[model samples]
Target: MTNKLSAGLAALFSLGTGPALAAQPVDWQMGFQPAATEIMTQIRGFESYTLWFIVPITLLVLVLLIYVMVKFRAGANPNPSKTSHNSLIEVIWTLGPVVILLALAVPSFNLLTAQYSPPEADFTVKATGYQWYWGYEYQTDEELSFDSLLLQDGERADAGKEDLATYPRLLTVDNEFVVPVGKTVRVLVTAADVLHSFAMPAFGIKIDAVPGRLNETWFNAEAEGLYYGQCSELCGKDHAYMPIAIRVVAQDKFDAWLAAAADDVEAANRNLIAAIDADAKSVDVAANVKN
Candidate 1:
């Protein structure tokens, strides 16, 4: 137990010291991004749970196909039995799938409930999707709001984020959606022009942003860092350009950022970025020492 706790703490520290950019897909990436929230952990767990059913069933079907092809070949069995429908086999097949579905449904329902059932949200943010960008409004505190535009290639140097590690191409934004780590942040999603999807893989959240209707989703980030996502829905020609960047920070930092952003967004962003860089450097130094 002690070792496990220590290893968990080490992993969190590593994540803190890691890249400043939000979680993005790597070249030749296949699986989901690293889970930074309880919901994402549950999502990964449910994925693994379903895999147990999928893998064995797929293998069973493959083995059966091979056996039938080899054992009942034309050369081996010249006179084939006209067994069209066996009651026993039919019952087994019907009951087998039912059992499997029931097994899957139990966890599936639980996951759905956990996903939809938002615990009393600490704060709510309204995300309004535009033609190619996102506008965030802190509904709880009307004083804070900003538009998150994609950082273009030419703007990277001006933003002091030339390195891909600090701000990834097409994924980085001018203003990120900031939330405190370990807090349940309820996001109300909508669109101004067309349909869009606000998806954050690490948080296991993907909700549609309809023009007239509002969709809600929540995520409580366990680790403090940046987590990235993009608009999943195909809204327009520049749909791919709009990316979602979220910065999860400690509670005190979040409070300070909120206060500063309420006054001046640009200055607040600069301060937040500097603080994050310093925090990452400190964590890196500690990790190096422990090594």
Candidate 2:
């Protein structure tokens, strides 16, 4: 009887933390941002662990429900146990949940520490929110800034004409935040004007960007994909227009993009210098002609 009781308790404990309580992402929508990183992976892991407990608990409850229905029917065991004052039963029931909770607390604490612990980041990016657009800044590189706006319906149709298509419409942006896959990206979030929240559901990261204040978060995507998000906080009338898009590519692709951005800056500078030289030449010719 003791062995049977032990087996039952073990089964009950396992049932308490089982599959039904596993944590899953919202859904399998075509995600663009990135894949499970250290933080998100740990979160998902804990969720699965939590589900393990929930599954056995649910099964135990279900079994008890069915057992009560059949075993306590009027035609079956008509008389129920009237001894409700058993001190041992009371103590056992009271301590059972406490023990279960203690068991859960171990993994729960480990996961929390993993999620919150600061990692040895590889790069830092500042994500600033404007009225209806987002600005990205690379901390290590100067003049690495650009605005990301939402593509119009016509633009979306044009993008579809390309070979590889991104997320449909729920979260697409004209300019995407580009990063190298498998790199630790430390994000420093701030708002240019009003309050906005930088949220990417797949990454399990959401931080508020407030004016004059900076909030920080980090994620390292394992896979290369376009992930989308929006300014969750209602800042103004155009809050809905704000969308966040991220493109995680290979390291070589990231290097090429950086070079492209550098070339654009250089070209703009060259154009400005040429225009200044032309103005000076014109002034010199006019002065010589007058003399």
Candidate 3:
């Protein structure tokens, strides 16, 4: 037990120093982005659960097809048995699909229900999708509003986002949706013009934004980090340019930024980034010392 615990700590230290801890799409990544919310974790679990039945059923069908082709070929058997109505095979086929459906239905329905039925939200934020950018409004007594545009290459230095590895191109933005970590945030999404979708893979959220309708979703992020996402819907010519960035910070830092963001959103964002960067460096140094 002592050896196992030590090995686990060592593995965690290695992971802590890696870039995978940050929530973003890694290059050559095939699977879903690393889950940062409970909802996303459950979604990934359900995906794995469904794959078990899918793989075996696919392999079984393929094997049966090959057997039928080889065994009943013209060269093998000129007079193939004309037994198309086998009661046993028919009953097996009918019952097999029914059983599989039942097995899948229970868990699938449960997950769907849980997705829509969120707990009491801590606070609310309204996101309005425009032609090529997103605008966020904090639904509080002292409401704050701002538009987040894609960060151009030339503006990276001014915004203090020059590190491509940390602030990826096409995914970073001028301002991010800021929220306190470990708090449930309900998002009301809608479109100002054409249809759009607000999707964040880390949160397992993909809700449509209609012009005349309001759709809502909720997420509670357990980790503190900058999570990146892109507009999944094809709204217009510049649909690909619309990216979403959410910065989850500690409560104290979030409070400070929120207080200052009303006056100047850009300056507040830069200060928040610096604070987060300082926290990250401190963590790295502490981990190295322990090692």
Candidate 4:
């Protein structure tokens, strides 16, 4: 009853936190979020590697444009030079592009190979894309499956997720796809109604979710946190609202949650959140004690 009143008051007053959640990007963040996996680390590295070539080439092109604008004006040269055929200049221009393209292509091809060549997965989960939500199935020995939906405004405080800094509005879901940290998680992706995409930027994973076909991707999250993604393919009007949230926890915590979720998912979620909160509180207390 008290929780309901708080949620209602929050909704009525449009109350929310000002700071951006960790799962969210800060204002004007130019690069990707800090990489959470090895693949994402390599992706960031490749981006920087390409920029080394891109920046110099862009500057060179700009300088050539300015030089042409100044040196080849009609007043400066009544006749444009018809001597446009120099073998050395032609060879340099042609070979320079070839060298640059070859330099870019080697790493590009290697990155593509790495993205496809995933190590053996420890376990598998099925993620089915719906019109505006995601359904996940833990293909473990117990095989528990559940549909995850966005948390409505009225259900905030009741779920113990009223803390906006942790569970930001719109990004928070009722049930998140839970996995164990430091374990390779394989996701079988497909769609039920229309074409959608399963994309998680932090893990450098993006794959198409076709209706009848199943696509596969894998990620090994090193740190534990609430990671967020969204449907990359436009399926319907509510595509923007379809959010993907994954909770990575310790193996023991995951085992406990998995065992409890087989009977009641909601209760299992509540217990899991309670455990996580307790863990956080313990860490805070430890820090204070050290101080």
Candidate 5:
């Protein structure tokens, strides 16, 4: 046990201080959210505090259980103490739990407030969950919208051979939610059909997508990469089909993408208006000739 414990500690320390520490373990999808930024730091702090409370309490209980079984067995203690009503022990037990709870609640409450606190978000996105797909809208920006559907097996294979540098099958989407890194993005989640959950584990966000109700969550990704998640709630037969892919790009890339989306929406609207006007003009000319 001693050797095993020491070896485990050594391994943990080594990984924590490895040479490639600067490079996050995104390739393997192994590392925790890098808390170098303030928001992520708050999340990491909550996780660490919870672990601290859980680990020692679990160990202490396990050790005490083992010690009692081994040292105070039936044979060892033939005559057991029959005193069951001790006010002092009761008070200690009661107060001990209360004190431990207070210790946990203090930080837990603070973290909850921080997580739910609304910030002056840089952007807003409304994610609409469909039966087996997603639709995203740039709520605060131009009236741009897009539908994201899962790739079929053959489609995924072709994409892998052609667009390998982009993304993989289960993680890839027809449309990606693009955002600038280091910006607080407020995501308004809802469903168009059945119930689903918008969950991104790395961002530590999981909110239900209920029809006729909007759920909200926020995240500020400080690094640039493609993060993937799926519809967490079991909605229907193809619940697994709906996936969420977000691309966090550099500020410049994000700006470019935004401008492009805006331009596309504008062009589409202009073409639509022109077509309507041409139809109206042709109708008027035809009516004049008939008269």
Candidate 6:
């Protein structure tokens, strides 16, 4: 029974921290993914602020509705009050919404400004959306370029990553967009064919990929891990299959990966997977020690 209880607690803990473990949507996930960047943190804060207003307002309206239904029933009040309008109530309702709007507007505008006004980028990457895939070009120094395609189930099995933990269904890709952690990355987003949206939920980035027009967005991921997104816009029949995977690593690891990828992408991916596995094992061992 003790062992069973411990296992149950562990499962619950894992469920609670699932979003943090992977920057992808999980079953029964209602809120945003664990924030990986400063913009996402601000986004979450604004959401919380809106929720504070929404919850109380909704509850108050509900209570008022219940009170009116109970107190103003036909049997309770035979003579209905002919009062059409209360000036004080009207004034309060009008001014109350205005105040709420103003409160919301301040933060909303600030968040928009922060998101649009990116810091001087440490590096720039150009993302071009295709009909069924994404192409990434490192525009800074090395001028490395590659196309990322969604990895099929069979391909995942061939890569020996059939487990959902490693290669999530419909989310994993052949080539992940790699970047260094804690550095501002400006992404110039465009499209070669139909429209697509370059979105990363954890990074709070979602910009349109319009053909012949480059839309810019930026993110500075603070943690090193694998984050997943998808083409948010409906481009074609295979829009669902166009997955976006980003791997944030340390500067040295990124440098090595970039160099290797420029030479041979397959070898570089294998090396990255090995390094990720090693890092995961070390973390697990440290957790076990603490336990």
All candidates: TM-score: 0.91, 0.66, 0.92, 0.91, 0.73, 0.88
Tens-place lDDT per residue, model 6, 1-291, is 665666556644443222225688888999999999999999999999999999999999999999999999999999999999999999999999999999999999999999999999998999999999999999866768999999987798555456687479999988899998899999999999999999999999999999999999999998877899999999989999999999888788889999899888877987877776666565545445545
Best-fitting candidate, scored by TM-score: 3
* Residue lDDT tens for model 1, 1-291: 665666567657667644453677788988899899888999999999999999999999999999999999999999999978889999999999999999999999999999989999999999999999999999766389999999988987666567787578989988889999889999999999899999999889999999999999999998888889999999989998999999988899889999999988878887888887787788767655555
Candidates ranked, most accurate by lDDT first:
3, 1, 6, 4, 5, 2
Tens digits of per-residue lDDT for model 5 on 110-198? Answer: 87898799688998999999998888899755667887787665765433323444455566665567777789999999999899999
| Top-lDDT structure, candidate number | 3
- The whole-model C-alpha lDDT of candidate 5 against the native structure comes to 0.70
Worst 10 residues of 1 by lDDT: 13-22
For model 2, state the Cα shift of residue 208 in Å: 2.5
Model 2 gets an lDDT of 0.68
lDDT of 6 at 279: 63
CA RMSD of each candidate after superposition = 3.3, 18.7, 2.9, 8.0, 16.5, 4.2
What digit string (tens of lDDT, one per residue) describes model 3 on residues 59-163? 999999999999999999998898769899899999999999999999999999999999999899999999999999999766799999999999999999898
lDDT of 4 at 217: 94
> How would you encode candidate 4's per-residue C-alpha lDDT over 1-291 as one tens digit per residue?
665665555443321111122455556989998787899999999999999999999999999999999999999989899995899989999999999999999998998898888899989999999999999998999769999999998998888889877787777899989888899999999999999999888888999999999999999997777788888998999988888888888899899999999999899999998988776655545444544
Q: What are the lDDT figures for the candidates, one per model? A: 0.87, 0.68, 0.88, 0.84, 0.70, 0.87
What TM-score does structure 2 among the candidates reach?
Answer: 0.66
Residue pairs of candidate 4 with colliding backbone atoms: none
The segments of candidate 3 whose C-alpha lies over 4 angstroms from its true place after superposition are 1-20, 288-291
- TM-score of decoy 1: 0.91
